[model samples]
Target: MVRATLGESSTSASVLCRSDKINWQARNKPTIYPKNFDLTDAERIGHPKQTNNGIYFGIRMGTVYGRLADIHNATFEYLRPQGGAEEPWRIGDFRGYNQAARITPIASELSTEIQCQAEQAFACRIVHNTNNNGGINLDEILTFMRQSGMDTFSLANAYPCLMLTRKGGTTHAVRALKCWDTRDVTPLYHNGAWHERYYIGMERGTLGDAAQLLPTTNGSWPLTVSVFLAGVLAGDHFDLHNWCLTNDGNPAWVLPQAIGLYDACGKSATYTVFDDSPSGGNESIWRVYVASLTQISTGIRFVINSNRNTSSTTYQLFVDVAGCGSNSKTFTMPQYSSTNLDFTWNELRMGPPAPAAGSTYNIRMQIHSMSGTSATTLWWEGQKTITIQ
Candidate 1:
């Protein structure tokens, strides 16, 4: 039996190209040289053959000769060996040999480039923009976060990823993936290294030392002087007015006196004095004063002085306190002429209820004549501090 040389020997023959020779050999021979070839055997043996109309079976190697361009264009599917033991099977044309092996290296390179680009973008957006063009500062960013309902604690608790790069100094890059713990007190970290800082520190300094640190701009001096003088004048006037009310009488200073006395008494008292004689009318209503108090046994007292002109009439006085709760008292004054009337309201008689500590309380007073309303008028109305013991 005449046999044709295979592989490199068949390709080396100058008279005919490999494809033409293989075709001539197959047609001329009684049986193909390679054991009466079968597609199943080709697959099992890791060799595939292309035959009749571009059909392929199993893996394709250089065994079955064809046009070089046709062989290159023909699609083949087989397992390509990777670094590990298991090879991954894939399908593609000749150009895609060992495609899976190329993936990881390319991916690693791309990942590094992407990370660098991300860092550059972050620096441009945050550091460069912040330092130039009056962009946001760290304080402003913190303020915005707070306004958006994020507190320092929240920020500290957050797992924010940051790629930090310092410019203009010792250049370095830090990547903080997820590192922050803000509860009471904790240290900060940059790329696994502890960052030292303090929210509050007590450093030795004096008033003169602080004064020396003040900016020496021309406008600063006038601003400082104006603020100092305004504060001094305000303090002096406040003291003088309060002192005068505690000693003498000033109708224009009545509310200020009440507030000043109330504040001096630890905000536990409500004081008000009104002279209704100027209007010479039947009704007198005073403005409300807000006071603060603790939850304690308290009482309100009023001094009512009737003018001689107040005819035979019954006067009704009302005291209203509103705050965490509401309370009101009405006093009945029988016919009286030029007489001093005293009324007291203990906690039991008041309504709704006494307020908790630090709660604001509003006090309002009103006086009117019940009988003979036209002729009767209240000469003076005064509020004494409620006893809180």
Candidate 2:
């Protein structure tokens, strides 16, 4: 197979190409083979096949990049709803759309299901794109698949066999489908490693090796951030405002949701944190003050989910409206009682007479401190709503 890469094959630079860095006049070097292939045979009484380095059954599946994309908390979710993570899988492909989830005790210690996108990812057999862009070394991958008579790409020459064996941390082997179908995917988290029970025919295909490591391809470790969305089409528009994240449970100051999609509730999104900081240390959240040219901005309201600790906690929650009569309004969080632990809603008003719709207005929010000692926590940003017109 003939493959081409300029200067250095550090990474598939097609995604973030530098026009001037193109070594168009560079000489054709060597077709260095991939090092990650771990192919085996059906245990013939004799030796291995003489062709393609004894890779008689299958070729190494180059690389797959992924992470949990944004997850919407269904309206029915009363406890820990939104998936908690900053969305590390933001690469522009289906692999990046891989899911993630959290497993937390809701009311009892029953170990409920948080089926992270990862668990469901391998279970459902997610299909990977064969497009060689972004350094995936498609030339080599395609060559092996085609030569082995396993290449079943579509008419457009894109979607090929979604089946491949992973090598590194875990070696996952899923059965190949005669054709692709999204609706047929099922949720299977029975075990961490799910391999095909029966390989090709009624009998088994090939069993994998115990533990092997062969580093091949131009792909790097801790992969590049590739964003993805399953349903969003080839050229669909997913506005930045659609991802209204308040906090990713990081130690840094929370930035204001600029194009934040919000209502009376705090933010459209939220993540979980058990005081990622020092135990018992205090934590604070912020909403940088902002002024609108033509809109009325009211104060914010705080809503507590059912999963909050029974041992009542306090947050010195306050809001600052730049142009309002009472520029500052503080609402101390009331403790949770047996009767009030479920839906505790409190308001921090800007002493309203309503800002004129066409007039200018500015607003801000601050949580002086929220005790981070408890394992069962509440994120102020996600639970509160900002009222603005």
Candidate 3:
């Protein structure tokens, strides 16, 4: 029987007729050689395959990975790309995408604000940089705060003074409950930065609310002695209201049974209480208002005048200390009450008393009228001026 034989280092077999060559070598094959009939078919195929042996000849996922951008821009299998020169394969650099950073890194920020009457709010921010590409979003963004290793923010968990320590330098720790929740997110754009914000609010975490009032040298803020001293050692900073701001005046009519009644229908009113108790009189009040003035004076004085008078009247006057009373001093308007046309330049003066100086009153002007009686109405008419003397 005749059988096919392969050369194996291999010695050759002689043949009287033509024979077909089949390459069967599995190893140690040269990649480039001359094309000639003298070589075996296996050797010829190896050299031909080597000349065209790049990714273009044959492609598999194990060898080359084609991208969607490349396929999207592809034209035909056997020509230049679909986009011509401009449309290169968008596998990588072809799409013009920056490889520096696909997703921007996020930075955090925190700030504090003092509202009216020592209220407080802390603001937090998450910033995304576009590398100066300049883009903005006007949509309201409310991001809940995320911090590692701390209590989660909630409506019932807005702690004001939970942690007032330092984060670094003057930066206080951002542990406010408002910053932790979605309740305080602020959606605002400013200075061309892309960012989202969160807020932390506390009612009483400010220095003024938490710390005791310490007397300060400048005293610009507190402006009182109690702000400097604590406990029961000193008086209140605002309790005195001035020095003190109060006043009381009493006018006693000596007619034990005298009653003044006037009515179209004869409705009457009576006052006989001052008859038995002449010291007890009709009390009138006046208030002395002071604003931001705290200077002390030596003493207070009183000066008054009248242009004309009709009837006679006598009364006693006295000063009031704080809310307490003082003894009365009597006086009479004899010259001024001579007639209804008593238009004389008669003036009465009192006070500047006791060489007492440098006293500050909190808030009142008090006068006590001990005794007086009149059958008709009395009027003191003049161009009057009263001032601190």
Q: What order do you get sorting by TM-score, best first?
A: 2, 1, 3
lDDT, model 3, position 127: 37
Residue 175's lDDT within candidate 1 is 19
Q: Candidate 3 lDDT, tens digit per residue, 1-389?
A: 11122222322222201112211111111112333223342332222232222111011001101221111111211111222232222221112212121111222323221222222323333333334221111010001111221113221211121123221112112121222222322122323432243333333323332322211122222211000000111132212111111111212211111111111111012111100111453111111110011212433333321111123445333323342233333455442221111111111122333222443333222222233332222111111122332
Instruction: List the global CA lDDT of all models.
Output: 0.23, 0.22, 0.22
Tens-digit lDDT track of model 1 for 215-287: 2322221100000000010132232111011111211221110000000001111123432221454111222
lDDT of 1 at 107: 8
Model 2: residues with Cα > 4 Å off, grouped in runs: 1-4, 8-299, 302-312, 325-352, 358-360, 368-388
Q: How high a TM-score does candidate 2 get?
A: 0.23
For candidate 3, give the lDDT: 0.22
* C-alpha root-mean-square deviation, each candidate: 36.0, 22.5, 39.2
Window of ten residues with lowest summed lDDT in model 3: 223-232
Write the number of the candidate with greater lDDT, choosing between 1 and 3.
1
Worst 10 residues of 1 by lDDT: 256-265
Estimate, for each residue in 1-389, the C-alpha lDDT of model 2 and write its tens digit.
01122234445323212223332111111111221221121211011232322221112221221211111111111111011131111112112111121111011111111111111111111222223122222234334445555534211222111122222223322222111112111111112422111101001112224112111222221211111112111212221211211122312321111000101111112222111222453212211111111122343332322122123445443344454432222333433211111111122233345533444334343333345632222223211223345
| Best by the lDDT measure | 1
Task: Give me candidate 1's TM-score against the actual structure.
Answer: 0.18
